[model samples]
Target: MNHISLYAQSLVYIVAGLNHFLNPRTYLAIMPPYIPAHQFMVTISGIAEIILGIGLLFRATQSVSAWGLIFLLIAIFPANVYMATSAKFIKFPAWLRWLRLPLQAVLIWWAYRYT
Candidate 1:
């Protein structure tokens, strides 16, 4: 289960990394309005994600990847909070809607443990 989770998480991050290229405008749109130099931010984030995904591919780098992911998640959290508050961007089932924020914490913990 530990390996399974790590692999799954790694795959998700890889896909998300690719997303920066596949949908560059959408990725940029997510940046908070106060942010400047949106293009640079998106490109840097994409590169980081891809690098982190590759790092997670090896056991020797797994712990470092885990810590990197934890910080990555923390860094993007304000976007999650923004999305949660802006119903225009998020629509969760009644049961799951309330769980999103808390689940981010759980996911961070889970990655920390299994990574």
Candidate 2:
């Protein structure tokens, strides 16, 4: 990945990870029904994002971090689907919820580039 893309990816993950703690309710509101322990899952994923984001900055860890992020994206994909399919559960507009589905794919592809 180019420097700009790498930096952007890192920032995205870092900021998002921080947001999980700063605004856990937003994330909790979207947690799929099938997923257990919503709060724990959110916190764990937040930590993962922070670690992966920092890992991406180093040459030694970039590839592994990218793969880790790709796996993380895939793992969390069900939440995206749930959000898109169950718009009534959340306050977000239908368009925005639907938009997130494709954005998840883009994020996966972005992370894959580094692998």
lDDT (0 to 1) per candidate: 0.76, 0.91
Q: What digit string (tens of lDDT, one per residue) describes model 2 on residues 79-98?
A: 98888898555677888888
Q: In model 1, where do residues sit more than 4 Å from their true spots?
A: 87-100
Instruction: List the candidate 2 regions with Cα displacement exceeding 4 Å.
Output: none
Q: Model 1, 99: alpha-carbon shift in Å?
A: 5.2
Q: Write down the lDDT that model 2 would get.
A: 0.91
- Candidate achieving the largest lDDT: 2
The TM-scores, one per candidate, come to 0.79, 0.94
Against the true structure, what is every candidate's RMSD?
Answer: 2.7, 1.4
Error (Å) of candidate 2 at residue 76 is 0.9
